[model samples]
Target: MDFKYDVIVIGAGHAGCEAAVAAANLGSKTCLITMDMNKVAQMSCNPAVGGIAKGQIVREIDALGGYMGLITDKTAIQFRLLNRSKGPAMWSPRAQCDRNKFIWAWREVLENTPNLSIWQDTVKEIIVENGEIIGLTTFWDVTFYAKCVVITAGTFLNGLMHVGKTQLPGGRMAEPPSLQLTESIVKNGIRSGRMKTGTPVRIDGRSVDFELMSTQDGENDFHKFSFMNDGTQHLKQLQCWTCYTNEEVHQVLREGLAESPLFNGQIQSIGPRYCPSIETKIVTFPDKEQHQLFLEPEGETTQELYLNGFSSSLPLEIQIAALKKIPAFRNLEIYRPGYAIEYDFFDPTQLKHSLESKVIKNLFFAGQVNGTTGYEEAGGQGLIAGINAHINCHGGEPFVLARDEAYIGVLIDDLVTKGVDEPYRMFTSRAEYRILLRMDDADMRLTEKAWKLGLVKEDRYELMKSKREAIKRIIEFTKDYSIKTALINDALEFLGTTPMKYGCKLIDLINRPQITIDNIANYVPAFKQMLDEIEENRKEEIIEAAEIQIKYQGYIERERMIANKLARLETIKIRGKFDYDSIHSLSTEARQKLIKVDPETIAQASRIPGVSPSDINVLLVLSGR
Candidate 1:
């Protein structure tokens, strides 16, 4: 077989899948190499996708023509719109997926993608000559040449799995570690560190006592992650069960502290802080009496169930003993025991905004290998890396998403600017312009740009244009249409809100927190007629988008103004190879950080942890800003 390619993506997890598809779809010949092709896009930690800020990233990925949302919508077993009680900016979509089906869907998409090939093999070392990536060598000693290489190795580099005192050399439960690649990269001047993450034990569903737990059913109203189709409508919904761990269970786990891998120093690396293990939660919050655990099904055909929020690395006997203490798990039968895995990750500060390694040209790193966690974060980086790898190979300008434009941008910026000491996960709080980057408006924010960059197809781009036009028409209709106060008094009174004193613009009424388009549509005949005139398929989204735009008009405008102000800083370019040490007026810490990160823009330099406002002023003056 021919071994030459434009891009070689190492790994087939979420990052690798997106990266391969992106490059191939952009007309570059791409090859995805993995140890096990059957496990492509494996939900290593959870059989789910999208949550909080993560949902926004997924939506953004979909908007950019990435396959994650499409595949997720097709395989999801349950769906819910989180934070519905909150404003539109806070609302996020999350899905509980059928794990096996999710992987199958990804494999099918990859196999069918044009110019993309799948190879079942482990990448042993990256081949680089001088300062640029040339290709990679597999374990079988076969060398494949490529112009660029995207490494999404995930938790396989020098991986070490821990369960109590027993240690194993594996990336996951059954997969072996990638030692040679890790060693080669380190020797190539790429700084690396260790990170720890754990997964919950799988239990047999037949042994679970559902009567003792509360049933958490899926949303009755269908909501999908992908904007391209209505695939979520046809899936069979599944229910999850919730139970609590009392002080008794905690005491049992405490007894196993002597043998626990986390406490016994068998695993010293940091795990995800937000999704801590049950043992860590118990010890960290000792005053709390109980912690909630969610039982999620792995798949429809399989009897295996995931014990969410109960991730642990204690001895198997102790885990069973603790499980027996819980009323709902008295007869629990284990499918597999939970274990913690420590893997090598490179410092993201060593990379540019395009996710390309500064140490080596045409070499990119994404996903867990960049010291970040979560499927969405990995997919976002992979998409960017894949797109940029193609761009770099074809002599095109690097494609980058600004911090104001996407959560993906915020994630990458944070990683490259501040540098992570622990495993970093995305949260809504991380993005200052989240109001402008809402999940509902991701397509409006990114589709046009992606289309210009050749990532989005013409059909999807046309759909996005039509959707935006529909939203515009709806917003204008709301502003121009006026409703009589007397006619709407009854509905307003029914809602327990103050009635309008005179004829008010429909948009003005919508600006009230208590008043919604649906509520107004019932009373205003003209508004209901206007909604009917809109295309039936486009009605729901148009109404929702119009409401958000009208209701939060002021806040959205303010955020845009702030973003515009910050845009100037980004326009002031800082040469990637500029000598920061020559700026004698800069602080010592700022000089060190600037030299280390070599930020490409003044705005990026300002975001670095050690660079102060004074340092930014110095940079601005030096750059003639």
Candidate 2:
């Protein structure tokens, strides 16, 4: 039998779900094919989403009309604003979700999404003609045709899970691996490589000694993953328990290192350096006496608690012995032992900034397929790929984001420019313009673009406009409103900030470290009155946005200037026009990298690994700049 679609997404992981939804919402007939329907958007590794730089990415995804942030908010069992003591730029929102609910939420969205169809089948081959993707063939002997295809196969492609010496063929535990798909694409000129990642064991919560561990409670403030969702608790909130692994635990792990698949020659693929296994941690940090671990609930009703920071592929008996060393886990009864997964990932450098393949037209890759580790990173890439896929079906300019514009931009650009030697994960330090990519203003930065593409609904676009206007009003008011010394001096003294000798602009007081809008409002009647006029639904968000703008105005302006200066090079298009191999003035490495990347702009070309400033000067000379 034959099927046709405008875009075919080959997996139902975070990336595939976002891609299919985005494309279909944009009016394209999109088909999402997965090996299993029950595991849609499976939290195979962890039940939590958004952390550090990843939270910012999820907010950006939300701003772009993707469903990850919304779904996370709906199913989240606990929400915490990470890095609260840091500057606003460093503030990130994280949530521990109900694992089962997360899957159900995504599945419900996919099933109800217009113009999208879900099929339970594994793709065996990708059909291509004249150097462009036509569609794919599933294992069930059904052929599907499309103008474009997004491969979010994740770790499913040639997946191999290892628990010590025992190995299993599965995408996830108990799920079979996807076969033939990797080889089918690799033989078609795209490059492929292997990566390894692992998850910690799940514990029976009833057996855990909560009295021995530190209790980490979720925040009850007005903070959530999605801007559209009000901060309401639908599910029962749960507290995560934190414990430490002692010298005894480390010694047991050390003894089992020889039997570990990661240590042995059984697994050769590179794993995430940032989130290493327990065995790797001990080996890397031999001097540290203890390592911290968090016992997080997988769901509110389920007693299966995920053991964070204890990921390993050590022998099952050794794992059990190590857990017994901790007072809290002395009676640890586990659902399953921790295991490391080795799977195939394609070289992301083989793709364009839009995630489209350079060699194969209308072919895109996202998620683990692009050698990225986190769900937020995968969702961002998927959204871009989905939008581009829709644009590919109907003639339009390709969609791309700048490094300064969004974290998603930095991720894709880094992937295509530097490529990956190991599994790539998002970090706050990775983005050069993070000051401009704060979690607070994701909607301000990207919603208009999403609205222009018809990916965002009218109500959402209106909300963005209202929020923008409200923030502007607050900033403008603070810029003009001067306070009296008599009224605020005592309040300032109470807040522990220096009392003003004379009257100053409202923003001047807010710029002080100890003073916050919430705290200082008691002294400033005019400011409080203005804030009170706002609708209750969006009042806090508007006030926070305004306060951040006022407090970091100087930093924000400076970063914008730097971003604007760097953005000039982005305007110089050289993607298809460059013939670096024919230019003798360029270095050989520069020529090779330039030819390989074929960057869309001079800015992008400047970022490619082997391309130096001298090579960029040569390109400028050739381009008549």
Candidate 3:
């Protein structure tokens, strides 16, 4: 089939789906080509969307008109806000999904997308001419010509699965590897390196004894991932069972260690160190007597349950025998044995900040191909790449989010600037301005930007604007309203807070560490009445954000100041072809790395590994700043 499209996206994983949708929604005639159409948005590893810093990225994606958060909310079977005990910056919304439903929902959404067309085929080679991407060629000798091509192949490029000495050429379980595409890209001068990831086995949920495990239920009030999704339909939730690995399981793994693919040199790629396999955990922490195993339901109606923490690649019989030793898994029937997959990923240093390749213009890479892990991280990159690709196609400015603005910014900035040696995962610590990038205010921070790009719906933008106005009115009310001492004292006593000595404005009182908007409402009827006047959801969010602002006021303001100072450096642009090697004041290593990477901004150049603060100052002086 010889055809032309405005944008062609390779792979139908989280990254590809988002890329296709984003570009198509932005008015491009987009085509998504995947090896298996059935595996669109497949949760190859786990049946969960958001966790820790990853949740914030999903929320950011939603705020910027991406479909991930909406799909996650629609198909989630259970919802919980992880790290709630910590500050709002640390609180992350996570949802346990019905694996089958999630993928189906993604397909349904894509089918409904106006400008997107889905084709089932392997993209064998990306076509380039005069150093710019033209499109791709499929394995069946079909040509797809497009202005831009996004490769979100996600561990499918010459994928190899390892189980002890036994290895197979495939992506996931039954899907065949894209052998020709790997060679094609390599021959085109795009560098690739190996990385490994693993998933746990699936067991018969009915066969496991529930009495021997602890039940992990959803939170009392479910948290929705999308700002657009109300909590009306999130009523029913499934439960996850927790079991433990005793000494017996470890000993069995230890005995089989010599034959393990990871230990026996059968696999060379580095897996995610944070989400280590059971074998790695046992070997790394020998003093540990036991490890927790979460047996989560794969779907509401299905008997298959994923063994969350028992990921391994030992022989089939050894895996079964060891699994039986776990308290709740005594009668477990393995649906599949856990194994590690090693695949090719490119060094992100080769790509520009827009996720477009420096060498191959109009060509972009996202997800595992960039050496990152997690569905949320992959989706985040895909959204950016798609947005930038759309911008590039339109001859408009690229949609770039700074580190201080959104978690998506932190994710991409880290990838382009620092680059990754191991599989990169987002964390709260990685973001320098987490205070400004909280999940609650994602829409407030990004909807306007998205709206200007014609990516966000007008009605949604109007809703966001109205919410902003309502929040401002509530803040004004709190600033003007005052309460008497006796009533305030009564509320304070009830909340274990010391009574205030003088009458104060509701906002001033709210700024007190112990006096939340709810506390003020319990005391002063006026404050409560003021809240009731606004929309119910708007009321709660304003209160929450305002309270956080009051409590962390000093720290937040300080961080904002620091961000603004850093923003000044970003204004000092280093042209794409600036010769850092000839700059005398810079160190030899910094010069070498700068010549290799050719970062777009001084801020980005400062973040590169070999660059020092003094070298940045030297560059600023040399640039006549």
Candidate 4:
């Protein structure tokens, strides 16, 4: 094996996988080293991918030539488009993936990817010389060299898991913690903090009472995470059962609170606010009758199920008692109890927009190690880090995505700009231009940039281009084509929406909330005929994308204009141009924060927590922009 490469990615979790694949595909010789070979892209928390803003991030990953979306599509057992009642901006594609198959699928891609190698080993110490990364030494005492290194250690860094009074040192269930890596990196003058995250108990399906729970079926549609998909479902479809926790369940959890690491002060780190433990949930919402839980299948053949929304760090027996209190789990058998793990995370503010360390050149950070909580967020960072690491090695302009351009961009900007007080999770509300960052248009927004960088394959790039062209045709046809009220009123009234009073362009009718290209096509045969001219494979997806653009054209354009206006602030370069402390007009807080953040542009400065709009104006005036 070669001892040297252009980039080496430590830890093969979602971030490492994307980083390694991205760098390698960009023609960089990349090596992805991990502690275990079988657990690549392991679904440590949940057996699902894409939710809320997370689904948008996954779509962006696919658009930018990352492997997560493709791997997820191949392993997904059940698929659903979340936020269906909402508009296009909130529509997120989620999939219940086969956990084991997900790992196998990711491994298959990593193994076969060009210019990439997978090595099973723990990275112990990163070798830095003169403030630049050179390589790293593994736990097995094997030394490897690289021009750039991305540390995506995840929760493995000094990992410690707790369930009731029992505490164990492990990354995941059985994996050993990477004990020295955090210390080694922290000594490099980078700030680090501890964060807590937990998972729910696995269940034996035979013990679950399906009759007592409401069935949540997956959506069968053309919507999927990756544009590269053949739009075919891979694994056999399965049903997920939804149940709720009653007061009886809460009483048992309350009784066990004395021993819960989260409450008893056994754990000091902060956990994810959005995915709080069952104990936290009960305590936080005392008046609520029940909290929802989903029983998701682990794989096609396995009876093992993941108990979502029941995450806990309470006693194992208490966890069982809580589940048994619920009618569905009356006869519940279990695989393993839920537990919380505390691990090391670096302050993301220490990293640049490219996810490279500000202090150490060419050394990058991604994933949970950057104080983020989900697979989607980690993969987005990995994709960017991998791209930048290659560029850092070979020399090019830093690739920074604006917040309006993508959810990935918003995530990185928030991380590098605001840092995190707790484990960060993405939500639709976080991105201001979410309307422009719709899930259906990830390819339209990002694929061409990736293609130009040589990260996107020609075939995929061509497909994206073809899809875009088809969508444009659909939009144009809708704009030009008109329909009489007599022809469309019956269909509209039948659908329980207002009937048109007069003739209108097809787009104007489709713009109505109740009207959709799919629904309207059924009534207007001519519109359906035009849609049929699109490629058969992605006909539905293209039509939907076109419809979204048409319906939200006004909102999308407004958001785009706002985003563009703010983007001009991005061009006013302020970094390294001012000694913020010397700028007397800037507030003391702004001065301190500006010096600390050292934002590259006035727009980034404005987003920093302590920097006010007035401070931004001061910087703008000082920068003569």
- Report the poorest 10 consecutive residues by lDDT, candidate 2: 229-238
Predicted candidate 2 versus true structure: per-residue lDDT over 116-203, tens digit per residue = 9999999999998999999899889999999999999999999999998999999899999999999999889999999999999889
Provide the lDDT at 497 for model 1. Answer: 87
Residue 238 lDDT in candidate 3: 90
Tens digits of lDDT, candidate 4, 402-503: 998899999999999999999999999999898999999999999999998888889999999899899888888888988998887888899889887889
TM-score of 1: 0.98
True-vs-predicted CA distance for residue 548, candidate 1, Å:
0.6
TM-scores, all candidates, are 0.98, 0.98, 0.98, 0.97
Model 3 CA lDDT for position 66: 93
Q: Distance (Å) between predicted and true CA of 604, model 3?
A: 0.7
lDDT of 3 by residue, 1-625 (tens): 6999988899999999999999999999999999887889999988998989999999999999999999888878788898988988898998888888888999999999999999998888888889998988988899999999999999898899877678998989888898888787777888889999998888887788999889999874535788787555652589988878999988998998998898988887799989998889989999999998888878878888888888887777878888888877788787888988988998898888789998889999999999999999999899989888887888897778999999888888888887788899999999989888888889989999999989999988998898788777767887788767976677778777778799877777777666677766866777677778877654666667667766777888899999999898898888664677677778999988888778888898898899999998888887788
lDDT of candidates 1 onward, in order: 0.90, 0.92, 0.86, 0.91
lDDT of 4: 0.91
Tens-place lDDT digits, model 1, residues 455-538: 899999998998888888878888898888878888899987898789988888888888888888888887788788876665
- In candidate 3, stretches whose alpha carbon ends up further than 4 angstroms from where it belongs are none
Which regions of candidate 2 are displaced past 4 Å? none
Question: Would you list the rank order by lDDT, best first?
Answer: 2, 4, 1, 3
Q: Worst 10-residue stretch by lDDT in candidate 1?
A: 226-235
